[model samples]
Structure formats: structure tokens, C-alpha cells
Target: MAASVTRVFVSHLAGLPVFDPGGDQVGRVRDLVAMLRVGRRPPRLLGMVVEVLSRRRIFLPMTRVTGIESGQIVTTGVLNVRRFEQRPTERLVLGELLDRRVQLVDSEEGATVLDVSIRRLPARRDWEIDKVFVRRGRGGALRRKGETLTVEWSAVTGFSLEEDSQSAESLVATFERLRPVDVANALHHLSPKRRAEVAAALDDDRLADVLEELPEDDQVEILGKLKEERAADVLEAMDPDDAADLLSELPEEDKERLLALMRPDEAADVRRLLSYEERTAGGLMTTEPIVLRPDATIADALARVRQQDLSPALAAQVYVCRPPEETPTGRYLGTIHFQRLLRDPPFTLVGSMVDSDLPPLAPDTPLRAVTSYLAAYNMVAAPVVDESGSLLGAVTVDDVLDHLLPDDWRETDFEESEHG
Candidate 1:
């Protein structure tokens, strides 16, 4: 049976003093030994080193210990120190962490770690007190291995974070159900001014991506706190259509102020989208779609997609639209999945790969129609155009998914992060 845990103190056995209830001189506390058994449980009896008369030393089991103090471990009754003998099990202490890769638990999750925690056991007055371990990921905050909220030692009632596959499977499940809007809601809890500051710190494109995730109302609230120039910089980074929607949501004076602060080219593009009805294709499209030439090589098409730096946005499906040589604008070609690009020969001409059978939507196409077209065609993005099939822009899947996810999704993400 494991010994009861109570307050205990430790000191050098040879230097410390101990005495019996009758005031008879007793042996001093010395070294401590903990068992190192692989696969089998460690010994329940914690041992201590003792030094006595005639220059003799002995190992005493903690189970035999009766009294403890800041400086001494008084035996159940004082006796000759030689009565206890050292065991072979005491020969090896657990090695340095780097010497062996040990399996341990972390946050109730299985974590491969560099070291484990150890401290004196209050009840075990033997050599080295042994009971609870601050296991490097070995023992600490014990969440359900992968819970969104990680509670500390004080909050933990009890736990058994297994260091195995069960722990990893739980983490994977939590990740799959995680959503972006949950992230936005948690970010919303911070003051709008703080949010704007964070937005400003992000690159133009990243800021735009975050803005897209935010609700229109929240987007305006955050932008309202930023300086007009900074707000304009973020707007310029967003898709022209998205910027127009956000601009429309703002007070007219704020919109005009931000537009005035924007770069001339960016302002013009946003203005063009803003002129369209909010419900139309032109109003919901992205102006940054990959517009490739018919004569371009597969490598050139891939390079064009790379320039956008759109990670985690399903960039594999790049829109193959107009060529630069075409008069006012070339005919809008079909979109290609990134996987197809990789599978085909690098020398292949992009024109041969164009799938003209793609469904087309005009600038005035309704939102419902665009969404249906995306679903029916299984396209990552559907190019929106005019009567002449001129490329207006493309509607990507991420924008659609973001629109569908709830605002509170960000909260889940915030709660999941350990560092946060």
C-alpha cells in the first residue's frame, strides 16, 4: 500500500540529528533510494540513508519511519542503524532525461518530453522523499488530454492523462470540430482598439483574411478604432468586393475618409465594386484571381498562383481567366484544380487544359445562383463575368465557408490554445 501523504521535510542524514522518545541518542538521516523498475511498479517503501556510531551507514524503509521534522527523521523507536541493510535495487537512480526517452503524460496528454518533475514527499522522511512527481509533461495541469480548458494543479480534482494513442485520438477529434468563427468570437472579446492594433501588425493579406472571417459589424467596429490611413491599408489588402462591402457597412463619413486615405489604384478598384448591387456577382467576387494567358506553360500558371501566397485557401484550384495580350479583355477560361496542374507535364500549354465546359455567371448573377453553380460544378471558385465573358473575378470556397460558420467559433479556438 502507498503511504499516506502528509507534510514532511528532508535534510542531510549524516549532518542531521535524531532522538528517541526517552531522549536516547539515535542515528542521523542520510541518503535516499527510489527503485527503478521498467514495466513493473516502483517500490512502495521509500528508503532513507542513516549514519550512526562506529562509522556505520544503513538504508531504512520509510514504512518504518515514525516521526519527522525540518532536520530529522526520528525512527518508530530508536535502534541500532546497522539493523537496516542496502538493497541491490538502490544501486541505480533514474538516469538524466537525455540518457533515456521515457513515456510520460502531459496535460493528461501523452507528450514526448525531455524531463520529469520530482520533489520531496512530505510523508516519506526517508533518503529522497518520493510521492508526487512534477513529471516533465509527466505531471501538472491534467486536462482530459485534449480539452479546450487546461486546469492547473489547484483546480485538478483527479486525472490520469494517458501517454498513448488514446490521448492523441482525442486531440485529433477536438481539432476536426474546431471552426474559424470560434476564433473570431474570442478575438471580439478584446477591445476593438486592441483588435485594430493586431490587425495593423499583420501583413496586408493576412489582415484581409482575418477581416473576411470577422462579421461585417465586428469588422466595422474594429476598423472604426484605427487611423484612417491604417484602415485604408487593410481595406486595400482585402478583395475589392469585400472592401466595398465593409466600406458600405461603415458610416458614410468614415467610408469617405478611408477611401481618401487609400492608394489611388486600390481606391479605384474598390470603387468599381462598390458601384455594383451588393447582391450581385460583381459585389461578391475577388479581384485577385489568377488571370493566366492561353500561351502560358503549366509552370507559369503555377508561378502565378504562388505570387498570391494564398495558403489554406484551397489555392489548388486556380482560376484560369484572361491573357494580357487580349484587347480590352480576353475570354474568361475555366478554372483548374491545383492537383491537376501537378499531375500534368510541366511543358504542357495551359490553353489545352482549359475546361470551357465550366458554368459561367454574369456580374448580375444572384448569390444563390453562384453558390449553386459552385456546388454543381464542384469548383473551388467560380469566375464571375459580363455578357462578353470578361473576367470580373472569382468566388472562392473559403469565403463561402467563412460566411456559413457562426461568429462564436473563435471562442473554441481561444480556449483550446495552451499558450493563450
Candidate 2:
């Protein structure tokens, strides 16, 4: 630690009030974001997520944060109002890293991470995680029987992804509370061998969710390392469109081999998605949208929308078809937005409330046209209908945005001066 540095434990700063230069309260610190480095390097402090007066969480970069002292945080008063979206290179300290199990580098003794300390770098605007407070014990930090010690970050061995199976399990346990995207972000920072080990430890459903968020290369690498049978299971668990996109990156023979191992129904959905152009509506649509029959009531629609597995865009509305409720459903009747379900009586039939004024997208619609349609109609998702007017699936705004952004966008680092 440098002479000018004053180490502050993150636990003490968790709910500290943040103020502008004028001393007006802006928000309270909800969580700190840090960028984990490869190997044993200390993670760099990125910024903190603050809950503002309106309860909207926003990113407050470290550069704009002038001081953290006197049980308060003082900033330059400049903040980005856009909701903070964690990138693949970042980690939420409070939410993910706390209470983790690690080991002492020299003694190789098991230890539990109680807290970590951050200090401003010498003669620079940067900050880094410098110290780790740990308890040497067989159980977690909650047990007071172990010897507590404060050590330099490098003195810890189990924090890195390259640790053994036990350590990997601890890492997985630490990530259990995070969203799939956050878990994928943490994985992106690990070495190939270690990344594969962690991915293997995750269950089929969890691994499928993580694979969807990972870049194509990482997805291919992790999937390649799994047993062929397991890989098929994971593919089956992923959304049909995402699974198809991943399969497209593999060699023709390998793709076919995996597809052959998958369940017939799941493979069929993926195969249909694969038949479309990579950048077309058919290629980007997910076959698992909320689908209902005309006779379904508003209550039924609301209940389907409440599914925990659905993405916000997918849950934003329900597609009403005639006979079959699944994709490639009977003649596409219309769609009912989520708001309509809340407005109408519970007994109202979804068929009578369908909003069919907006034309549905065709399977062959180009990606550019799909983008324009969503923008023009203020829709989060647009239905895809085949030549027979059978509902195929839906293309969501998030998927379109994923395709429209630069290929390396997920790996791009956020600059310190971004807020300044």
C-alpha cells in the first residue's frame, strides 16, 4: 500500500450515502463493480452501482467519485442516468464476491472471504483491491471459530479460476445468486482450461443460460470440451435460435452429430431456425414465445406472462393462435400486449382483445426491416409468420440489438473517463 492510501473495507461502504461537491445527497451505494484480471492479479475497482432517489440503479464510475471518507462518498456530481448493464469483464463485489471460500497461498489452508479492501493508487486516479480479510476455518465466515487474518490479495490462492474442483465449487456457489449474464461475465475472464472446468460444474439449465450470454468463440470452446452427450443436453436446454446460431459455427459433421444426439422435438426447432439466413427474422426468432389459444382468458394470459423463465421481451405480450399453442401454431390470430391483460376483466377472451392492426413479420424479412418494424411500432418483440400464416416465433429487440452491435462489443472495456 502507498503512503497516501487509506484502506476502506467494502462492507463499511455498502450503504454509505453519496453526495455531490455541493454536499447534496444523490444516492446510496448499493454495490461496487470490479474488473477481475487473469491469474493472481488484484482486480481493479471500476465503479459503484448507486440507487438514486427514484430507485433507478445507475453506474457511477470511479473517476467521478472524488472521495470516499467520513462514512460518505463524494463525487463530481456528474453521473450517467442510464441503467447500469454489467459487461462481460466486470464483477459485482457485494452481490457475487463476498462470503466466498478461498485458500492461503503459502500455508494452503482453507479460508473464507469476509471482506476486501480498496485503496487509491499512488499518484493516479485509479483504485485497486489491495487487501482481503479472511477467516481460516472449515465452515463459512459465519462461524467464529477460525483465526481471522488480513492479508494482501496475492496471499490468497483460491480466488483465481484455475483452482481445483473444490475451489471451482466455491466459485460456482458464489455465483449462484447472480443472473446468468453476470456468471458468463465472470467466466469470460478465466483461462480456457479453467473456464471449461467451471462450465462443467454448472447444471444443464444454468450452463445453457450462461452459454447464451457468452461470445461465439467462448461458447464453441466450452461446448467442445464437454462430453458429446452432455453437449447435446445443453444445446437442448438453450433457446432454439441461440442453439441454432451456435451450431452454425461448428463444422458440418460436428453440428449434425450433436443435433442427432438431441431430443427430436428440440432438434426440429433448431433445424427450422437453421434453415433461415443468419441475419434474417427467421434466424433470430425464438420458438418459445408465450403462445395461447383464442379461448384463453385474460387471467390465463397473465398467468403465462408470470413465468420466471421468460425474458422481459418475451413476456411483454402473448401470441394468440387457433389450435396448437406451440410455435408454427395454427393460423396466427393476433397478439395481446401485457398491458391489455391488466386492463380488461379476467374473464375476457384473449381472442376478442387481439391487436391485429400491426402487420406480422414474414420469415424472410431482412434484419434491417425487422429493426425498423420494432422501432416504428414501439414493440419489444414482433411475431414471425410463415407463408401459411402460421405463427413461427418472435424476434425480440434484445436479439436485434445483439446482432446490430459490433462483434467485439461484449469484450470492450469501459473507460475510466467515460463519466467525466
Candidate 3:
């Protein structure tokens, strides 16, 4: 948390200049990232999306931020140059949360959120949204303004409840607290028109997650409803293999059109997966598995595993490669399980601790053989390599089960059956 400012409304921080320790301007704040919890709990502030001089937006983790004054922010000069990508559990304060309708818990009076104040916890680096400034009225903040008040976040109710509504805004807010599968179940029961509306309203990453859980027909319908560019963006957010599967369901022309609209790098990964037989290891593998260089330390592996966005299976181990860390990476070396990372000292070189005892799976390995490999080794995920020994991707147990399950499995109301 920034030491100079204990509490600052997010609105005030928006577009504020961000500076490094030596008084050099680095970027301007574009938005704040917050992780939403299960219930009424205030979302923890994750970091800021800062746009640098070159017009490139990057993530500035809160841990690296040192001060937040009224005019500018000060960082420890550390920054990650990767483009900011919102995860399924994250919400952007400015883009998604502002100007939304909510109700005061005690009064039940409707209000529109105008701003939110975040505060750093005592003696801790973490911050959480604590107060909300809302305007009471029927219209947005710019029009028909009425009495405004700052209330504790707990005083608001509509942000997480599944209120009865056909409007996409309310529906999206309702789905905010739900797991992707749960949201998919709710969407499955919605009228197709309503389902498309909700899907269109959700942010790209969130929509991608929910789409992955939906039935193929529903996925196709909702995707078809979105604009071509938006559809491409959502596909880019999905796992490469899942995106390839969804693209496979489309007509050849439609698939090609969407692929053409996607970023070249992202589209390339999907194209590679599409080249393989649908029932093979290559087809089932996700291209975004954690890949590390041989020179990385156990500490580095642990840090990569701690990312909140990684699926448990993907986070279960890291693949060590020669170079070009991305999938289809340089010569495949071996894998280091999470347990191995935990056992070794932080300073230990990952290359020295590599677990190369097990033979890696070939990209064309049949689905049955892939499943057998996982079961035989009790591994949650298995690496997929090509004939030339380049690491392609990793197939996880979940994708295998998705393929193995009955076609109508997702349609079953498992929650009701278990509770009944």
C-alpha cells in the first residue's frame, strides 16, 4: 500500500501521474484491479494498470508501489511490462463497477455508485475497498443528481445478489459472485435471447471462463451473437485448446474470420492446436502452461505457481525448457512438480532439480494413451512434445474428463441431485 495516502477515492487516483523513486514519470493510472470475494467482503486491491510513455499499458503490482499522493504515485521502480489482462475473479473499478445501480442495505433505497475509496490495512501491504460514494436518484451521475453519501461497502446490496431482472447489467452483477460453472448453469436455463444479452455484457475474460463451461450449442449461440471483433477478443482470453475447440464448432468461414481478427500470436497457438486430431494429446493441451528457463530458481517457480489465474492442474508443475519460454518452446528439458519446488531451498537451481525420469507424451498420442499416462503416473497434467523434441503444451486431467464424460453431462443438475 502507498504510505503517503492511507485512503484515496479511486476516482481521484484515476489518470494520476505515476513516478518512480528518482522523480521520473513512468506512466498514468488507467484503472485499479480488485479481486472479488465470495460474499459481501470488500474486494482486495490487486494493482493498477498504468500506461507508459510509449502507450503501452502494464501492470504495477501494489507490492511495488511506495506512495500515493494527491497528484502522483511513487513506485519502487519495479514494473512488469506485460499487458494487463483481467482474470476471472478480478474487477476493474473504473470500467465495470462505477455508475452501477445498488441498494442501501438498511434503507433499501436505490443509488448509483459514483466512487469508491480504498484503504491500506494497518501494518500490511494489502488494501481493500472500504467505502462507496453513491448518488441517490434515477439517472446516472452526470444527470439528475440527488443526495450523495459515502457509505461502508457492506451497506450496499445489489452488487452480488441474484435479483430478478432481464436487464444485462443486473444479471452480470448477480453473476459476479458465482463460479464459472455455476454461472454457466444459470445461463443454460436462461432464454437464448437473455443468455446472449448477459454474455455480451460480461467482460472478456469472465465471458471466456463461462463460455468454457457452457454446452457447445450454447457456446456457439452466444458467440455468434457477439460482434466479430469482440468474439475474437473473448477467444484470445480463453485457453488455446478450448478456443480451438470452440472455433472447430463454427463453419470454416466463420472460424477463419474470427482467427483472422485475433492477435497473430494468440491466433497462432489456436491454429497449432487445430492442426492436431481432436482426440489427441495436442488437441487437449493448453498452450499457456507455466514454462521456465533452466536457469530459474525454485523461488521463481514458486512465484509462478502462486498466480491466482492459473488452474490447479496447470499450477501443479512447471515445464523447464531451453529457451523461448512460450509454448512450442526450445528443447524440452523436464518438469518440476510443485511438491519438488516446495522441498528444495529457494536458492536451488531448477535445472539441477529437474525431474526427467518420466518420458514426456508425444503430441499425437491418442486420448486413451494420454489418460493412461496420467493415471499410471498419478499426474494431474502431462507435457506434450513434438517429434523434433520441442515442448508444445501440457494436457491436464480436467480436459481429458471433459472429453470422456457423456455429451449431456453439463446439462445435468448435479447440485440439485447432491442436495436432494
Candidate 4:
């Protein structure tokens, strides 16, 4: 092996472009494949899972790789277009190793695996797993600020995951830091039993976020598997619009049961959203956007917008309202864009900077009308009001686009993400 062959971490290698010896682009590296062996020996690199044209995932053996440089991998001229399948002896480094919880063999201290480094053996042309990177902190807090270190692969245990032996707890822990969409994708790839187990392991809020990003079918399936109280809690944790969307998929009886189980206020918001057509302004709106009394100071509005958990779309503006400032109960006044709060003196009342030039969307407005309203006004989110001019909710651009996209857009997005 060339001594100059560079070592790369699996996390960094993920999604890098791959090209053939002829310089023709083949696909992007999706995951690293390795074969588990006896004792503490590092697993040998089998190859990589490359997502090629047509979004088909195929395997490329390390022996066929000619170079790994910059952000791309170069392979020999030959290629196999067959779809990649996991053999019993193989494991995916990114999917199975990175972010997994493992134990320090000597001290029994627990660590969360962060990344794995791989390099070519000095005397052979083959590459194998080199060092395991892990994060550790005192106490049992797996996510607390911790020190990271690279140890030989033999220094750790728990790398071997037999197909039938993988536990849901570890799988959920491995995905704790991943985005909701990524977690949903990983859940989609698991077997039904494993998916249910993983879902059960996640807390209500985390499960709710993942459910929102999943397909309607998946959303219903996972929600259905939970016990009544737990399912209701998860639904309560979800955004009202998303909760309504998922409820719209359930049978009317099941819907009413779950609604009754939820807190009255949360249930009421979802019920109101459910009363509208699936594609209309009311259906696409979230009832939880920031709301402030006209008398609220710029500082107060700023404080609400600064909330760490507030969604960016909803946080972009604060709806100024009459008494009972909360949505669904207040009269529609005007909206105070976040920029106005920043430009005005902190003590200034929001009413003084309210933007009332643009009309609020009627609750029953059609989808096309909402789209046009947002586009024509260049707004990220627009407020919805009842015929009596009471504040209902706000329809965000992201929610509008979600309803407008093709039904299969999620699958298409997964394919496009391979190259991103």
C-alpha cells in the first residue's frame, strides 16, 4: 500500500462524489461497508454503498478504488450496477457504528461513538477500520459536554450487531442528534418490528418531530402502535397543523378518541384546523404563531421571538391582537415583523410598528388564493382570520409548499439528498 494514502473519517466521507477511472461521474458515497471478524481485529473495508443513476444503491469494492482525494473518490473503470444488499457478515459504518453507544473494554466506561477512521494497511492494498472516535463525560449523561478521543477499535466492545440482535435503545441513541427528516428516513429503512421498537424508545416530543417528517402512512402506523395515552401525548407534542394532518389519516372514531385524550386547548386547535379542506388556508396554518397584545413593548416581542424552541417561520413576526392576545380568541389587529422590532426602540409599543397594509387571509381562503397572497406580498407567513376578523392562525410558506408538492415528493427528496 502507498504510505502516502490519506486516512479519512467515515462521517466526512459520507455523500462525497465518486468517479470512475475514466473520470465519468458514477455516484455519491452513501455509506461505508465493512465486514466484522473474530477477536478484536478491526473490520476490513468491503467497499461503499454508492447511489447511482436512477437512485439505485450499489456496492463498490475497496479493491476497485484508485484514489480518495479532496471530496471525491475515484474507482477503477469497471462497475457493478446491481443493487447493494447487506450480507449477514457486513455492517454499515455510518448507519451502525458512528453515533452508536459502546463500552470501553478495560474500564467499562460508556461512550458514544462519533466517527471511525479507516486507512490502507501498510503491506497490503486493502483498507480496514483504524481508530474509533468516541465521546465521554462523567456520570451517565451521554450527551453532556464531554471529551473526545480516538482509541484502537479493539479497545471498545458492542460493534458486532447481528441482524436479529440489534436493540431499539441503542438504535434510538445513535439517531438522537440526527435531524427529524434523517431520523424518519432511518426509521423507514428499518424492519417494522425494529421501527416500532425504536419509536417506543423515543420520548414523546422527539417522536412527534420524527412523525411530522414521515409519510402520512408511516405517521399513522407509528401513532397507531402507541398506547392511547402515549399516542395522545405524542400528538400534543406535535405542531397543531401536523397533529391535524396525522389525525386526518385516522378513522373518525380513532381521531375523536385521540382528541379526547389530549388537553382541551391543544385538542381544540387541532379540531379547528381539521374543520377545513386539506388544501385550504385554515388547514395549512399553525395556530401557535407568536401573538402579542398591541400594548406589548418591542422588548416583549423580541423576547418571544428569541425563544430557542420557536420555529423560524413562526418567529419571523408577531401578530398584534386585542385583549386575549392568544390566537383563536383575539381580534385581528396587525402583524409586527421581526425587523420592525429590531429597528424600533425597545420601549416602543408594537402597535406603533404594526404592518396593516397587507390584508389578513380569510380562514376559508382557497389554496390558490393563499399561494398568490404569499407570493404577491413576498411574505414568509400570512395570518388567517375569521369572517368576524378574529385571529385564527398563520399559514407559513413551508406548510403551503408541503401541500402543493407532488405526493411522491418525499421519495424524490431522499434521492436528491444523496448528491447533496
Candidate 5:
């Protein structure tokens, strides 16, 4: 039998020489650009996208592998490395999934990569992979020991591609594992019907996450490609703020159609957020804050983190408080950065960490004022409270910066500044 693919797979590339299929060294193998699994189990290596330079990347099919030695990934190509251009990291969802750590769900089958796909524009050519998700696949391990055969995808010789080129299968094989933005970009490469089918195949939470990351124009375009119900389902799964923002940007007819398609509760949540201007803290935060009583132990707070696994932005910090009391009027309290909690004494009352006795502001707090407040406080984040002073959500420093300095404009003044 031929050598096992696992033995040949290059997981480490400390001194791996990267050559232009021409044998001239262009650069050393900097990193595993992206790993795409072709089939269902043993997560067969369909294609490997590699970084050619700090700014450039190239795709190589696993089939081209001549060999894997002590510190190198040998390739069979003879093409110029300069031919490939660099894709923006924001658009590289495959890169994200390949890097993200995930639970492998130990079994006889090979591990999988889970990722979020995204799109850049309505008429863009391809989708992108934004975040890395490894240990992504899940399947069964044989219950009985004797009859079990743990076969990997590479070990099976019959798996063939349409073309001998490994690059051809890389995109399709990595379908489920691509980033949300990348998914949107890839759909642009497919027929509308096929795009809809892929959209349907995606899980709701994953779809929701991706939808939030996509550009508004791409979000609408992808939504247009989706079947009405599937489109609504994905929207419903998205964070209320993001869904609201997308809905607010959509045309009246499509907005109505999507909202009608969603469940009443979800629709209402989206509607509330839609009513707010996208630049506000309310527009930036998920209303679902993981709140705990001030008296709750660190263990109790951590249990909530495991249970809900809040979104990254929200989970940046967990808010501590008292259970709703008799008055239920002024539960105004402070927030705790997750890192702070980890470093503090385990038994310490979270109430002690409430840094800002300042009441949470209305979501309508002016952008200029928000920036000033955050800067003055040197805070990474601040809770957005309602009239009751109860924590509604948080406003991250980045979110404030996005409002103060949107992507559409350039910072001309900073180009010549020495004032700071």
C-alpha cells in the first residue's frame, strides 16, 4: 500500500521551503493558509491554501503532494508565486475556520472545520472565509470494539475529483467550513438556485452569525438569492441588532416579506432594534447580556457562560447584579470584564468590580458624547442601561470607533498630524 496521507500531511512547517512549482524558493512555508476537507469522514484533505508571502496566498490541492519531509511541504507546481494576489484578511473566511479551535467530538470519523462565510458585495465574484473553526466535524465512534474500522478519507483510494487538479475541489469541499463573509462571496460564484441550497444547508445560529458580519449590500443580495422562507429563517437566527440593521436597509417589500416570514417574537425583537439608529450602542449590542447576581460565585457566572456561550462582543464581559427585587425600579449596577473576573479572587463578590457607578445611558447617547465618555474613562467597554438603570447591553470601544470613524471615509487629518 502507498504511504498513509496522515504520515505525509505537514502539520508543522518550521523550516518548510516554499518553492514556485519551478523549484526556486520564493519563501518558506509561513503557515497553513487554509485546510479544506473534501468528503464527510476522516476529513479528507481536499485542498490546502497556503500563504506565499505576508501579503499573498496560493491554493494547492492535496493530490499534488509529492512528499512531506522533516521540516518542509513539498509541492509539484512550477508556476510563479507572484501570479497570486493577496486577498484581504476580512474576506478570507477559509483562513478563519482553518485556524479556529473547536471540539472534535471524538469518534472514528476524521475531524471537521466549522466556519462562518461572508460576502463583500451584491455583485462580488466569490464568498470569503472569515474565521477559523477547527475540530469542526462530528460523527459516531463504533460502540463495539471488534467490528470497528476507522478509515480516513485519504486512506480510501476511490475518492476522485472531476479534474486531476486538487485546486478545483478546494472551494466546494470546504463549503460548510467557510467563513460567513466567504460564504456570501462564494455564493456570488454560484447560480442563484445553488446559492439558496447552500444557504438552506447552513445551521440557523451559524447563518445568523454570518449575516451580521456581511456588508449590508451583500446581506440583501444573499437574502434575495435565498428562498423567502429560508431567507427569513436565517434573518430570524441573526442578532436582533444586526437583523434590524439589515431589515432597515432593505427595500420595503423585501423587509415586509422577511419580517412576515419570521416568528412573532423574533420579528418584534428585530423591529425594536430596527427602530434605533445603527450608530448607537443599542444598535451595536445584543440585548441578551449574561447577567448574574452580584452575590453569585465565579463558578455560577462561568456556568452561565458555558450554558449560553454568548456572542464574542457581548461575552467580552459579563454583567453582575442582584436578582430583580421588590422595587424592580433601580437595579443599576456595574460591569466586569471577563479577564478581570478570571484574575480576581474566586470568592470575591462581583459587586466590588462594578467600575462604573454611572448609569447606563439611553441607546440614543450622541456618538461624540459616547466617544468622549469612553475616552475619559479609559474604558474598554461600558454597559448601556435603560431608564431603570438596568443593564441592557454593552458598548465596546471598537463599536464607538466604528461610529466615530466609519469605513466609508478616510482620516485625512491624521495623515499629517503631530499634535497628539
Candidate 6:
């Protein structure tokens, strides 16, 4: 390896900023495209898929890149604005290579690939996969098991540039284990048609979760491609606030049409949120959260928190109210943090553990005020109550952040690159 050349993981290069010789940023690197060939050697790097300012993806041939380093990539100061069309020979590192299952030449058991390390070849003109990180074994094994190991690329088999039934299943199964944001990232790097196919393959809840993590444009695009009824179900599966946010971005006619397709109660909740200004608490909260009567036992509260579909932020605290449990009815009472519930005896009433000191948020409260309130109390979610002292929803920190970040924040992929 040349002293000047950096050996970096494919993950590190995925979103690095690309700049021209003049130091002007042209776009962010979305994926490294490469071609497999007939030798023991790794596939050769063909170019980069760059997502430019127009949100259109373009191909930058390897010859145009001058250098790769921490934080950014230096290019030959030239680029083509045309959308990228992958040749039959090309494959994406982040999208197609990561999370693949490959078999060892000497072993029948398959290993799940974690990541691949890539390095520039001699003359500093081309990059290729150098090493693969793989995990093997199950926890219940009596012998050596459940370990992650790194090996030369030649040690593994089953990687191919062509798409096969098994390859598609491997990809789908691997993606099933990833976080929603990770899935969204992989989806973003796929072609629009492929993205739609994958979205359709995912269950409604999983697809909804993944869609929540995608850019608004991508969210709209994938939803637009789904059947109207299916799209409505996916939206209904998403958090009310997130679904509302997505709906608010659609053209009025489209928004109303989709809303009409949704379940009446879910549509009503989204409609209520739509009435609030985009920058207010009402606009940032999910209409459904774990709400229990003040007299509910700690065991009951804990059970609510344990619901599989409750998001971490929403599960962090449970709102205490005088209730018709679905929506607070009797009156606004107080709140119970999950930590408190865990510490109290199961027989203890939530009313006894309520954090009465923390003030409830008014539905119309500005986003800025909500941010301050959460920071002041170190709360992940704050309850939103109407003037009638009925719980409206709970504004979560994640929602606040979604609004605070720049519109194109998802596209700004520069990371603190490592020197290796």
C-alpha cells in the first residue's frame, strides 16, 4: 500500500462529499459502482454514483476522481449531469455488496457479510475490495460460535454481479434484520423501479418505518407507486405525526384522496394534525401514545410500554390522565416516566409515580418552546393537551429534530472519515 493511499471501509465512502479541483462541492457519493471479472482478484471500481444538487443521480467515472481522503473526495473538476444508468456489468458496493451471505470454500455453513474493505490499486487509479468482514455461528452452539471474522475476498464464494433468485432472497432476508434508517439508506441507493419493488415486498409496518426514515421526496415517490389502498394502509401504519408530515407535503388533491382512503379514526387524527402550523407541537406529535388512567397500576403501565410497535421515544414515558384510555377523557392529570414505573412496585398506582412537576405542553405551543421544554426536563416526549385538559398527543424529540434539520439534511452525507 502506498503511504498516501488510504484503506477505507465501503461504509465510510458511501456518503463522502465529492468536490471539484476548485474546491467546489459537486455532490455526495451515494455508492461505488464496480464490475466483477474472471479472476481471483476483486472487482474493479468503475466509478461513483453521485447524488447531485438537483437530486438526480449521475455516474462519475473513476478517471474523474483525483483523490480520496477523510471527509471529501477530490475530483478532476468535471462531471456529467445526466442521470446514471447502470450497465449490466456494474454493481453497487453499498447496495449490493453489504449484508450478503457467502459460503466459505471449506465450510458448508453460510456467513453473513458485515462490511467490505476497499483500497486503491497500484498507480492510484483504481479501487477494489480487499477484505470482507463476516459473522458466523449461532449462540446456542456448544463449539466455537457467533463470531465475526475478517478474511481475504478469495476465501468466500456466492458473490456475483448477476441477480439470481437466491441472491434476491439473501438481499431481502439480510435487509430484514437492519434498522429502518439503514434499510432506507440502501433503498435510496437503488434504482427507482427496484426501490418500488423492495418497498412492496416489505410488510406494511416495516415499510412504513422505513419510509419514515427516507427523504420526503423519496417517501412521496414510493408511496405514489403503491396501490392506493395499500398506500393508505402503509400510511396508517406510520406514526400519525409522520404520516401527517408526509401528507402535508403532497398536492392538496392527492392528500385529500389518500386521506379519504385511510381508516376513519386514523384519518381524523391526521386531519387534526394537519390543522396545526408545521412548526407547532400539534404538528409534531403522534395522536396515539401510551395513555393510562392515573389509577392504573405500574404493571399496567409497564405492559403498555412493552408493546412491540411503540417507538423508543414514545415508550420512554406514559401519559397519566383521567381517561377513556384511547384518548384522555376525564381530565389532564400528570405523566409517568418509564424509569419511575420500573422502580415502583407493580401494585403501585401510576398516580403515585406521576411527575406532576413537569408541565404539560399546549397543543399550539411552538416547536422552539417544545424543544426547550424537553431539554429542560431531559424528556424524550412531552404530552400535548388541549384547552379542555384532554390529552391530544405526545410530541417526541425525534419529530422535533426532523423539523429542525435542513430540508436536504438526508442528502448531506459527509461523515468524519477515518484515516485508515
Best candidate, TM-score-wise? 4
lDDT of 4 by residue, 1-420 (tens): 232665777777766779887788988776789998898999999999887755567889998988887768888868887768888788887766765667899889977777899998776669999899888743345645678899999999887744443345545655665678767876776557667878998999899999988877778889889999999999999999999999988999999999999999999999999999988898899998888888889999999999987788889999988878667847778988898789978999988888888799988899999999999988899999998788899999999989899876766655444443
TM-score of 3: 0.63
Which residue pairs does candidate 6 place in steric collision? none
Considering TM-score, which of the candidate structures 4 and 5 is the better prediction for this target? 4
Instruction: List ranges where model 5 is wrong by over 4 Å.
Output: 1-194, 306-308, 321-330, 343-349, 397-420
Model 2's lDDT to the true fold?
A: 0.85
Model 1 per-residue lDDT tens digits across residues 221-309: 77777677777888888767779888998778878888999998788878878877766677777766766777778998787667645
What C-alpha lDDT values do all the predictions have?
0.55, 0.85, 0.85, 0.83, 0.52, 0.80
Model 4 spans > 4 angstroms off: 1-30, 36-43, 50-90, 93-119, 129-165, 415-420
Q: Where's the lowest-lDDT run of ten residues in candidate 4?
A: 161-170
Query: What RMSD, rounded to one decimal, does every model reach?
Result: 22.0, 8.0, 16.1, 5.9, 12.6, 9.7
Worst 10 residues of 3 by lDDT: 411-420
Candidate 2 vs 5: which has more lDDT = 2
Error of 1 at 34 (Å): 36
Candidate with the larger lDDT of 3 and 5 = 3
Model 3 spans > 4 angstroms off: 1-166, 413-420
lDDT of 5 by residue, 318-391 (tens): 77656662112237567777777788777887777765665565778776777777788766676777776666
Per-residue C-alpha lDDT of model 3 across residues 196-267, encoded as one tens digit per residue: 778988999999999999888889999999999999999999999899999999999999999999999999
Lowest summed lDDT over 10 consecutive residues: which window, candidate 5? 160-169
Q: Write the per-residue lDDT of candidate 2 for residues 271-381, one digit (tens) a residue.
A: 999999989999999999999999999999999999999999999999999888787899998999999899989999999999988799999999999999999999999
